[model samples]
Each structure stands twice: as structure tokens, then as C-alpha cells.
Target: MMKALRAALLGMALAIGLPSGSQAQTLRVGMAAQDVGRLDPHFATSTIDRVAVGWMFNGLVRFPPGSIDPAAIEPDLAERWESGADGRTWTFFLRRGVQFHGGFGELTADDVVFSLRKSAAAATSAFSADFRAFESVEAVDPYTVRIVLRENVPSLLGILTNYSGGYIVSKRAVEQKGEGFARAPVGTGPFALQGVTPNQSAELVAHAGYFRGKPQIAGISYRFIPSDASRDLAFQNKELDLNYGRADQTWATRVRALPGVTVDVFEPAELAMLHLNITQAPFNDIRVRQAMAHAVNRAELSRWRGPDVSRPGQSLVPRGYLGFTAENGLPGHDVAKAKALLAEAGYPNGLTIKVIHTQLPEMLNMMQVVQQQLRRAGITLDLQVVEHATFHQQIRQDLSPLVYYSAARFPVADIYLSQFFHGRSIVKTPTAVTNFSHCNQADAQIDAARVSTDPAAQLKLWAEAQRTLVKEVCAVPLVETLLVFARRDTLDYGYKLVGSMGLGPQITEQSRLR
Candidate 1:
């Protein structure tokens, strides 16, 4: 069915004078990031870089929209899979005739094992946490692979959908190409790297022999324009076919009104929050956390940001997650309640706090708004905005008492829960990404959810854990972000907010550009 759909789309594109062959025209895309460092899927973290690497790689399993059953894992290189009755062991059946781009030979189970093990190997990878649950990965035969888990992990398959975690790389290509392979990766996807201009832009050409089928348009290029306004200008000048991150709704409205341009909104499974350091003096008390939560005006902030663009966040788990509910949610604004809590926490006269943040123009605006809101509740906030790089370092070092941060992921409850609250994560470093009120008992509960096999049981446990964290005033939820994509009307595309931004290549056949 997919092949037939691809053929029909290709025929349609050809009829409209768009390129149908490998040397077809390049579809230019613009983004807010400056560069994509490595095209290697295993090492890449940023969404901008991941989208580029995604084109040049294939995973054993592909996630199609709206499907969660492991048995229904869509095929890329693997044709099918089966699990033992105990659910600890999983076997994958590889496709017989697929070959990697750039003249690598057929992919086999050994390559699968090598790729995963390399990701787990500390010397070779930065994504070790992604595969920490797997006890062993082995090749059962030339075309079959088996994975043994330390325990039953029902979310293992769902976790594999992450670009950093699940993408499969060719062992032959890596061994033959060595370190340079990251820049010039070879995969079985529709697009292959044509050229890269460091931090500026990258070009990709469709691989005619792509296993699924070739993309309708011939090639695609990503132009890095870090400034949102600059990206909008590029789109207006016909230099870009699509723009990924547009925060200004006013500019989005203007762009949509222009000729040959259209705007699409994607409701992301992402969270934007104000992370408070619970280990710090002022925030150590639960009353202090509750006071801050009640002091802020979420509804006003959401309105100021834009409608249908930002909804007041209720929990660390966004609204779309399986276990999110009002009962397990954060406390809303109540100035009197906030003042009372503040007094009880020994700050009756109110105390001043410092908010360390990056100096992005939009971010500064947000911080100013939050600062003013806190002042209205008789709480004084000192703003300490700095450069992006410096701010990130401070957060990672836990030197910052409060900071604004955002995370995008597939709508998996575990992704948010495990990454933020899991006890063993380096991201949960003392002053860093710790999601708990202070990373205490909450960490154990989150870990249990990750390794649990039963879905219903996991949901119940996670829900209870979330309720505890919210009641204890761990992290202050701000809003659930809605991603906006703007493009020239001549370009036709369908985007679903899966993870961050851009379309996943598994569904690229649905994309059309004239």
C-alpha cells in the first residue's frame, strides 16, 4: 500500500513539472538552529540535527502515527518481530533485500547488535542512558536479532521511537568510513547527504534505491537561520520552503496573509516550565514551592504568549499523557494563599529570588512578564539574564536557583517522567535537570514505571507519583507549547506534532511540494 501510494505521488509530481528522479530539485527548509554537528543518529541530540540525520538512517522499527502496540511496529529494515511468553526476550526478522546507500552491502542482525552495543559503550556514545535497560543484544542468525532485557520494560518499544535511541547504523559503513562517517553517513532512507556548509546549510538528494521508495521531490536542503525574524524574511524571499520554529503569532498572522504562504499549527507533546532548585535555601521548603506556584498568573501568561499556541500547564506530564489529570495537577494562582504560604515558610515579609535565564529576545520578554506577575503577589524577583551558552552551563552545574526550560518529546508519559524524575539519570544531576521537588522518593517511583511491564499498573503508579510531586511543589508547570510551522502556499505538507518538529521520514510519502 505504501509503495503504491509513493508511485501515485511521484506520478502526480512529475505531471506538475516537479523532479521525479534522484537529481530532482531541492526543497529548502529553514530552522532556528545555527548548525547540525553530526549526522550520526546515535550521537545527535538537538531536534534540528536529528531531523537531518533521520533522513540518512533507518531504525529496526519505525513508529507510524497513532499506533502503540509493539506487534504493529512498522518495518524499515526489520520485516517482523516476536517476543517470548515471558516478554524479556524479543526477536526481530530482518528484511531480505535491503542495502545501505553509498554502496554498503545488505544489512544483517550483526549490524543491529553492533549498532546498539556501540550506543551503549561509553567510549563510543553520548546516548548511553537510552539503552541502559537492555542486558544484552545478540545476533541470533544472519537476518535475526535477539534483545534480552534486565527486566520487563513495557515502554522499551516506545522508547526506541526516540531518534537518539532507536536509529540503526551500518557497522560496515562505520568501520570503513571511521570518524568522518558522522558527517557523511550512509543509510537506506529516501535522502542522502549531498553537501554540508558547516553551520550554514546542508543539502540532501533522494536515494532512488530507497527501500520504502524514493521521495516525490528530488532533493531537500536545510538552511540554518537562528533568528526567527531572519527565517521569516527568508521564507518571504522564496529562499525557504518551510520555517519550523516561529514563536511570534503576530508575525505568523502576517506571513499567513501574504501570497503563496500558509500556516500550520501542531499541538506538541512538549512542556515549558520554570525549574526551581529545591536543594536551594528558599526553595527547600514545600511551602515555598507552593507559594511560587500560586503567585504566578498562568492564564495571563498564556494569553500574552498567544491563543491555541500556549495552554497553562497543569503537571510535568502534559495534558495528552495517559496519566495526567486535575487531581494530579499543580495549584493555580491565589495571591492570598501564596502570601500565607510565604509567611509560614519564614518569609512573611516576602523574600527576593534570582531568576537566571538566557538572553533570547522572546525569552527576555517572558521573564519580564513573570517578574512583574510575581511582584504583584508581593514577591520580588531579580532577573539575571545571560548568554545562551553561559546560561546552559549554569543550569547544568546547578548554580542557577531558577531557570526557564522547554522539552519536546513524543506523547509518551514515560519520556517526561523518566528523564526528569528517574533517580539514576545524569540529567538529574544535583543542580541540573532534577524534576522532583528534590529528587527523593519520587525518583524510585519513576524508575519503577520505566521497568514495569503492565500498562495499567504503570499508569496508576505514575499518576500517584505525579500527584505526590505536584502536592509537594517540585517543579512549576508553565504551559503546554503548540508548535507552529509556516511555509509558502506552493508547498503542500501535513505535519503531526510527533516529538519536536519536522515530519518523520517514515511518512515523507505524504509530503508534496510544487
Candidate 2:
């Protein structure tokens, strides 16, 4: 029965020339990896899925055309916004005449309130924590909504701009359909969800009455090709209009040489780190953690890929982050110091530790190189490579003592710090589901910074918290990632590298070849 259904869907997709069924001008996007499961905007935590949801939904506020900075919030559904002097109350004036797709009619303040409240509701979202700071959301009139907060949140606006926090759904639609509404979301965005095939692809069509104006492109067909090689091949064959995420530098160069292909490189606000489980024996001692940090030769790691690939990561926050400086003062490699620390930790003869790596070829290579460097300092590492999903599960369960992982963040330091180091963050699980390094003080400082309002004061607090985490060796910083997008050069689209993920508003604004 399932096979028959899939065949029918594929037949439909082929018959229409694509799932969107619009040949007038359809943009077909290729992704380097498959989405990490759910398509519901509120449940999307990974960059891969966020790109897809970015097209299917509209938030109260959005990042401007070329800017990914959360600080530069722009009007989306809401036309104007203001906050009280205390910064505890925020008021947003919704734009009238905006209507949801599928004949839902007009948008109002109540819909705004419903969307925001629903995202914060415990039963509906995994990211409720992002909005937990809010005290209440109320509709003042048909076109005005007011939000009251328990305290002054300096990053409240930034949080609201997050993909997970901003994707607004129709109140009436959700109420009518309940849980199934996520699969068929109704919004005031340029595109309307048309169909979805679990683990396959999702299709959307241009909404004729989009508030900004109808997109020049008739529709979008988002294909879910998990393999980077497959995506590259598709682009080479002119089967896709755009591709997201990085690819092999060599392959990227070749694609760039192709006629009509455009390759863009941008610095991503994400870092790949080697996180240690502090609850375990070897890493429990600060001396042992410091030894691991000092043993790594960051120069060699930086050179693993070409200059365009990565930058040496110096702090928890990436280099371009606000308040980041070279002199924030974190310890660096010193072979002698590493040896002395190892001896002090009662491992004078060195110790053998297991290093878990995800299935990504690049990450696995990185781990192997790290293993070689650690061996030079008398520390032996046993490499264990697993599928990405399994690796994440093991880490969340605290089943792995050491794991290679990456954390993506916006241009701000507050949300990044809170989600990783805060005691209550999902990343810091407590049971078999716990990934906490068991660094209690680090968690406390992160929590404190969340409520801090002064930018200067907040930076100082965050710097201290990061330094504390580094000094304790909770996570060893490796490299700040770069955004690498490969295309067939024939497509003309604009992309920006402003945030952690290097996607832009081009998906909603660009025209495609007929």
C-alpha cells in the first residue's frame, strides 16, 4: 500500500515536471543533507530544516534583505513596533489586509497573539523555553498586539526574530485541524504548503495575495536529497536552481568554473567543538580538561582545510560576534604545560580516551588528525564513528565521553550561550538524556546573562561565563565554520552570510527560468 502511494506521488511529481506543478517559473532548491525530521517551524532546530521552513511560513518580524543580525529587526507581518521605557512591554501594529492562504481570510492581532502563545505553550513547542521569559501576550485591537514580559529582556527582539520563534501559523487553521496543522500550515507568507512526503520532499506554491507582493517565481519545489554528491550532481545537470550548505572545496571550484554557475563563500556564525563529558572520570578534573586543550595544535587543525574553509576558533563565541576580541584571554597550546597537567591529573603515563565522531567525512578526518596530535602528548584516543543521528542521540544520552559537535548561533552571544550552557537547555540533559558537562557554575552564569539588559554589562558577564567554561575545559573550541554554497552558475540569486546559517530572503524574492 505504501509503495503504491509513493508511486502515485512520484507519478504526480513527474507529471507536473516537479511537485509544485508550475512550469511558468519554478525554483528548485537542493540541500546538502536531508532535513532533521520535523517541518514544523517551532520544532525545527537544525539549519537544514530551517531553510525549508523559511519559505513556507511568515513571522511577525523578519531579518532585512541582506542582514542576518537579530539586532536589525525588520517589519514583516507587523508594520511598526515600539516598547515601553522599562522595556518590559512591547507593542506591535499588525498590517491590515494580510490574509492566510487557502481562503483563511484576513490576519489580525488575535492571530498574532495565538501564534506567539502557541509557540510558548508547553504542549505545542520544543522551543517554548525561548519565549518563556514573556509574561503574557494580548490583543489590544484588531490590528494591535501587546506583549508583557516578566522582566527586561535585552534580547527579546532578537529571540522573536529566530526561525523557531518567528514562524507564525494561522490561529483558525490550527484550531480547526489541531496537531495535523503543522503538516499543512496556513500563513500569510509568499508560499502556501501544497504537499509533503515524509523524508522525501515538500512542495509549495506562490500565494497570489502575499503582503509584500506575489513572488516573481510561480512556485518552489524543495527536494530532499541527503547526499552532498547527489545534490552536486543535480546542480551539474541543471536539475536544481539553488543549493544550500557547504560542499567539497575542490568540487565547489569545479562548479564555479561551469558556465552560469555562481559559488558564494561566507563566514558562518557557527563553531565546531570537541565537547567533554565532565561527569566522567578522566575529564572530571580541571587539570585533565586543560591538558586536552593544551595538547591540541590549533594551527594544524586550521590547516586541515583551505583558508576559505574555516577560521581558527578562539572562544565560545565566533570572531565576528559582538564584543569578541583576541585579548579576552583564553589559554592556548603549550606542549610542556599539557604534559605537566596530565601528570598532575594522575595520568603521568597518559590515558586512552574514546572520541566519538559523526558520519560526516570531514568531521571524521578532523577527529583522526586530533587523535594524532593527542598521541604526541602521550594521550591515546580511540575513534568511534557513527551516523549523525546516532551520534546526537548518544551525546544527548551522555553515553559518549567525548564527542565532536557543532553549535550554530546568531550574531548575538546571549542566545548562543543560553542554549548551550544554561542548566535548563535541551543540550544540557540530566539523565540518560543529559549532555551536561556537569559544569554547574557555567550554567548559572549563562542563566544570569539572559536577564541582563545592559549590552556592555552583558558582554562582560558572557565573557566571564565563556572563560569559566574554557578554564574548566568543558568544551574545546576548534574552528569557526564557513558557509559554502554551490550552484550551477546559470541561476541568478542573492544570498547573505549574516547568521549561523547562510540562507537569505532570495528564496522568497528571486525569479526562476521558465
Candidate 3:
């Protein structure tokens, strides 16, 4: 009876657009997700999971709240750090009097060592591929941590910044709760995870003992509203102070016109790519893969997605990323040439291939656009649409012949190339990452770029790798879609929204509703 009454009241609130007094004290956010996959920072890859974990965890160092530049990284849990002359060994001095949430005790080098080691272990972390250079991590003392790399890297600080596989977790909490830590994580950030209500919401309270300062907002309510209409309706009704906005000009213009609403079309564009499985039958031929490439029209797709929110992707590495180059060795679109190539590959009438795709609105719509474009070139796509989570699982298991995936990484060429195109990251392998295309031709260039000391040398090697990948037709780079979000103008995040590696606005201790 009470549940029905609450629903009735919520419906009435939606109709009347009632403003809640309690909501002013707590920032309510609506995300397009059914639920968070994992709260554990090590395994949180989805936008919803990454956003929640970003608030609850801190790294030794961090990029400024709204930035992803490696040069802008500043001290967080670690006050200072020094690298050895060879750049192989580094030491970090921990901040004193830092407390972990949920009574996990004070932050120390022990927790840092544990968290980093866990991050490097392939058995424990999803991002273990990025830590291939780590030789060892140790606690020099309770307040000092030392890391030894096997070789010099382009930017050691880039890997240590607060992001995927770099977030520090409470050692004691993880050991005490074991696998239960995913449900209730402990960190030394400004916010603490309170609890999670399945398929509904996750609540986080401000950490009183945060090293920086106490958070201005009392708490955060992360509500899961999967439908675009429902999320927008909730925001219109004032139930949501901020919500994930659609990445389209129509949606942005519409939302910006709403009273007190501000739309943010931020940086770190996620590159949408079409990875053709070379191990599969039809795509095994280089001619077929080339045909697939020629069939994709980046401009048409970008126009369909919206020019303000997206741009034509031209390189393997995303634009604005370090070492990105537009000299990718790929030909321009030629439908006639594509059909000729198909005929030469013994598919005179073209071929049909089954593709497992996600039902997520943004991705689904992008695939549909690609589908129509491919149809013009006489290529038929048998799209098998499934739930978002199921799509991820199936694709990882190598069930999809053509995989349309989108991602925004640490804004480095090495991270993108090593994860998406390197042989070690090939699916169904011992060191499996996201190398869905099984492209190993550019492995040497990618590896060389990682250890190259000179900036010019590193960029050259990265450029060479991208050229090789494009020539191989391993994956067709599509539109680079920027992130979009909407918030009430009165809510202050205390930092300018530029580029967030976490893919959301980083709410900090100073964020508040005025």
C-alpha cells in the first residue's frame, strides 16, 4: 500500500513539477542504466559504474577535476613523488592523517601498495593490460610507497592518475569483505558509499574526514532511469538536479531552452568503431575487410548523429589525444570500388553476416545508420540486438563477427592502441583485452612507442602503428561522439567542465546546490 502511495505521489509530483526541499540538500542524478555493474573501481568499465566509483575513490595523483592532461596531474593521497634517474623506480610520499571511509582506518603506503598490485594482477583487475611495465610495488614505509617499472614509459604519471586501474582502494576493507567489497567499497575520497538498492538507486554520503575538506552536499542519490523519455521527464519534474543528456543538437537545443537548465557538450570524445573479426569466415579476406571500410560513410553518420555533438573520425587514435595523427593509410569512400572488391573476393552479389549488437539507444541508432549505409554497398548486416549487458558478454566471448564498440580511454595513443589493436589484448586469449579484430601487425610499433624516451620518437612510432592498423582494415573508425549532460544552472560543481576521463562531471567537496 505504501509503495503504491509513493508511486502515486511521484506521479503527482511529475504532473505538478513539484520541487522537493530535501533534494536541495542532496544532489539527485538520473543515469540511463538499469543498475551499476560493479562498484569496485578495478572492474567498473561502464559509464554508470565509473562515475559512481570516481566519487568514492582517490588515486596517488589525479588530473584536475575537469581535465585529462597528464601535465595537469596534481597530488591527491600522495603529497609528492620522485623518480629515479633511470625513470624505472619511483617513490611517493603519502599524505598524513588521511582517513578511509566506513572505518577502514587511515590511508597508508600499505593500502597504496595493495591497490596498485591488485590493479596490475590480471587475475584480479580488468585493466591489467595497462600495468605491463610495472616490475614491483612496495611500501617503503607506512607513509611512503615505491614502484619499480620494468622500463621507461612515455608518461608514468599518466598511468597513476585517478582513472581506470589507478584508483586507490582500502586494503583492510577489501580483505575483510573479500568479494563483498564490490557491493560496499571503502576509499579515501570526499564521498563514501552508503548502500545500493538493486535496480533502483545507489546512495553516497559525504566523507566527514576527507583529507581535502568536507563535502558541501549532504549526500548523492544516483537514480537509474533507463528510458530517455523517463529520465527527461524526471528532470523536468525537478526530481533530478542533473541527468545524462542525449548527444544530439535537437536534444541539446531543446534542453537548453528549459528554464534553469544548462547543457554541457564536453571533450574526450568516445570513438565509435566497427571491428571486423578477422578470424571469422567472410571477414577473413582482406578484400572483404577493405570492402567493409569503403562502405562506411563518416560524414553521413556524423551528420545523422549531429554535427555539434560529433565529428568525422579519421585516425585510429581519437582526436585531441596525445600522439594522434590524421595520416592513417585508408582510402576514401567508393561504393563502386567496394562492390568490385566484394566481387573479387567471390561475393559478386555481396554477403550477409550476423552481428551481435547492443540495444542501448545511442549505440543502437549508430549501428542502424551504419546498417543503412552498408546496404547501399550491397552488404547485408544481420543484426541480432540484445540487452546492453548481454551484448558486452557475448562480444567478449567472441560471439560477434562484426562488433561496433565505442570507448574513451586515458587520452593516450599507447592506451588506445595497446588495448584495442595489440595482439596481447585479443579476445579468447590468456591476456584478453578488447582486441576484437585480432590485429597483430602493428604490435612492434605500439610496443616501441610505449618505451620510447623521446617525444618525437614516440609519436612517430604511434603514427606508424595507426597507419599499419588502417591499412590492414582491422577496424573502421567511425564518428567520434562527444559526451553530453544537463544540470540545473544553480548547481555548482566548483570546477569547469572540460574533459573528464571518468566520462562525467567530477563532483567534489565544493559541489553544492545554491
TM-score of each: 0.83, 0.85, 0.94
Error of 3 at 382 (Å): 2.1
Model 3 lDDT tens row, 198-316: 87888777777888887776667888888889999999998898899888878988999999999988888999999988888898999999998999899888888788899999888
Q: Clash totals for all models, in order?
A: 2, 7, 0
Q: Which parts of model 1 have CA positions greater than 4 angstroms off?
A: 1-23, 65-73, 121-127, 172-186, 339-368, 378-394, 426-438, 451-454, 494-510
Model 2 lDDT tens row, 1-514: 4345434544543543343433345667776454344566776655556666777677778776456666677888888899999889999898989989889989998888888988886557656666768899999999999999997665676667636766777789989977777677787777777777665667777776787776656666677776767877788788787776452456556677888877766645457777777778788888988888999877677766556667788886677776454554567888789889999999889999876667655566667878888888888888777766566556766667777766565566766666555556545442111224655557666666667777778777778888877777777878765666665544554444344332433465444443
Higher-TM-score candidate of 1 and 2: 2
Preferred candidate (lDDT higher): 2 or 3: 3
TM-score-best of 2 and 3: 3
Which 10 successive residues of model 2 have the least lDDT summed?
A: 426-435
Total clashes, candidate 3?
0
Residue lDDT tens for model 1, 41-160: 766644566768766777777655323334555766778888899788888898987777767877888888988898776446646655677899999899999999888764566545
The alpha-carbon deviation from the true structure for residue 501 of candidate 2, after best TM-score superposition, in angstroms, is 5.1
What is the lDDT of every predicted structure here?
A: 0.69, 0.69, 0.87
